[model samples]
Target: MPTPSEPVDEFDATSSTAADPVLPAGYSMRLLDWADLPAVHALENRLFPLDAWPLSFFEEELAQAVPEPDGGTRDYRVITGPVPGSASGTTATGTAVTGTAVTGTAVIDADRDAGAGEAADVVLGYCGLMCVPPLADVQTIAVAPEAEGHGLGTAMLLWMVAEAARRRATDLLLEVRADNPRAQRLYERHGFEHIHTRAGYYPGDASAQGAGGGRVDALIMRRRLVG
Candidate 1:
């Protein structure tokens, strides 16, 4: 397995085209930075209210993206785009900003380019991977509601697959709610196979109980990256 300091021939951290999908116009993907936590946490609650991860979970994950001498084992990425209804990828304050890809050790100041009145670029999607040589896991992945249907999810999933392969992981694993057939299909289309099922793996949204909300089973899936 290649450490963070080691370069993987197939996926260069600094190369925009290496293992990165061409995103929709006006949208960009980059390494997840500390400054992105607030937006990521908020989006987590909105997207998975029933089992949203706390802010601390994300903080801990980001810390692992940069391995120490003992070894760190994680990769995370975030996709950003203009605020909806904003003009030409500019924020409400009419300031245009683009997210530049950064390495694990890089720091991005989300507000550096914006004036006091300007809003930071919107995080449209985010995904994470945890790799330890032979095995890699898709820690989390989500696309904002407004950003769905534009292939952002597919793009992120591809990044996970490529990153795991580059890290010499033989297989990649992830769990999805059984009720979320849409996501299941996306994984399936990307060559993931259903391998196991965990009963009642996800807590139900009490607020949505009137519409058939209850504990949901989790479908464990895996994709082979190398033999």
Candidate 2:
């Protein structure tokens, strides 16, 4: 099985011709609030086995996002996809979900009502960034296995580009695993150019079965935004 650790940036390499990718019909992006951290962590662990981030890290990330008027220092966004009403399965907010805890601007805690006709979203993927005035760094990006090939990853990157512009950032940067040419291609398509590489950067067990994971080089890329 292909590792879900990397984002799905391509569906058919040989026949795809669109210069810019677009999300499938019905998909949408929204600000990912603190309430969504638990769901984000679950999906992160699934997509990035060796590189899963701690729950506390996401909490910190959310706490860091300030309003643009306050010189916005961080931002997080999530992509949601529509699901058939008949599909009975787990969701961020569903009976299939167990207990939870409370987070800012959202409710979470262990075992809640059956949602009582509450409208919920199916989290397809998420992305985050950290900004320091003129520059912004791509903190993370991931897509669910079932949600790939629908342009969610591309859509997220494009959204971030606009976000950087909105925040008055001059450039955006990210690191892609050396083994992930698919992701590199996707980044290149978005105007990110190879800046350099960090040797032995990604210490993921994906290359190792269960033992202490080794490391892989990371290609650093940057995109300069036009004023």
Candidate 3:
């Protein structure tokens, strides 16, 4: 494990997830375990208060982190797999969930200096890529306000790029609030080009104007993943 104060990879964006999907070079990313829920939940709630999914949702995701050793991962979350109508459900509030975790995988790893016990996986700054056959999305990447600088966000994005490519993902996609220029810049630096935009995407009065008047837009960005 690398120490917190150690110098991180400045442009360490290249990594392969074929055999070893663990963190690349200066950073580390690992499969999420049941114990990581508390920290993940706390970050989700804090970074995305209006959109954070419930605790039960996290349980289901962790449960389906990978395919069962005997057979396969259950499709209780409509994540993928051949199930007649197996599909993850979401509330109007932007909470997408699965009754059981998806059969695929979920991963997390932060700076070792982020401290151990609970805070380790809390995503002081982190990124995730969800692979569900034929599609892969940069599910989420967040950093605590205090960790904003130090290039943690860029490192996380590079990790996701490597993960998506390893999954043989055709295209990598993610949606960021149009209002967040800093995030957009980070995405742009890593070959993500804007593909589309959604009007009134975020549902909250995070600004003084309120949800509609101060409606936030979501920019859907994409990066091709092929040789």
Candidate 4:
């Protein structure tokens, strides 16, 4: 039994030739909102069909973090691509607001180029983070199948790291499907190292994960946060 903290390098890789959507100038990031839930849920269902969380979870997350000042609404933003040359991603340091009570879901997006007619402000991807003792756990990250290679996942992860730092998190941990090599590469690029493995982590249909999937393993990964 290996501890979930041991670091290792090397992963089984996958090669899928997929084109990513074109993005516009100055991609922006902001908190997610209730209105964006439908799109987010759609992407999640597509990306994690086997283990998608119930819709109720989404509603609950948002409800929990609602700010009381204006009646139970969370401090979230629906990141829309700002006018080009307009500061869409710009935010004042330390003034980033949080919900009155930290009970609901917080959302954000990479939506800088959409308004320029270069891309739609649809959620090409999203990452979830939750604070725990010592570190922030990356709850999950999923990108639309069509948005695969646009580096949206990487941007989301980095944003989460910054968010975690704002919350005083010291490290980050996440579990990856054993068969997802491309994702593993993305994680590696972000300084995440394999810490351990979970056997039979993902169940597969015989059509896809047949004999080749027998050795399916989930990789537990961690990245140390640095100032």
Candidate 2, clashing residue pairs? 99-110, 99-111, 100-109, 100-110, 101-108, 101-109
Give the per-residue lDDT of model 1 (tens digit) for 60-123: 9999988423477888899887533433334222111111111011112324322221244688
lDDT of each: 0.68, 0.62, 0.50, 0.51
Residue lDDT tens for model 4, 26-108:
34445667778887776555445455767787777667554333343222223233322223453211111110101112232
Best by lDDT: 1
Off by over 4 Å in 1: 1-18, 67-70, 84-120, 207-213
TM-scores, all models, native as reference: 0.75, 0.71, 0.63, 0.62
lDDT score for residue 224 of model 3: 80
- Order of the predicted models by TM-score, top scorer first: 1, 2, 3, 4
Greater-lDDT candidate between 1 and 3: 1
Query: By TM-score, who's the top model here?
Result: 1
lDDT score, candidate 3, position 11: 27
Model 1 TM-score is 0.75
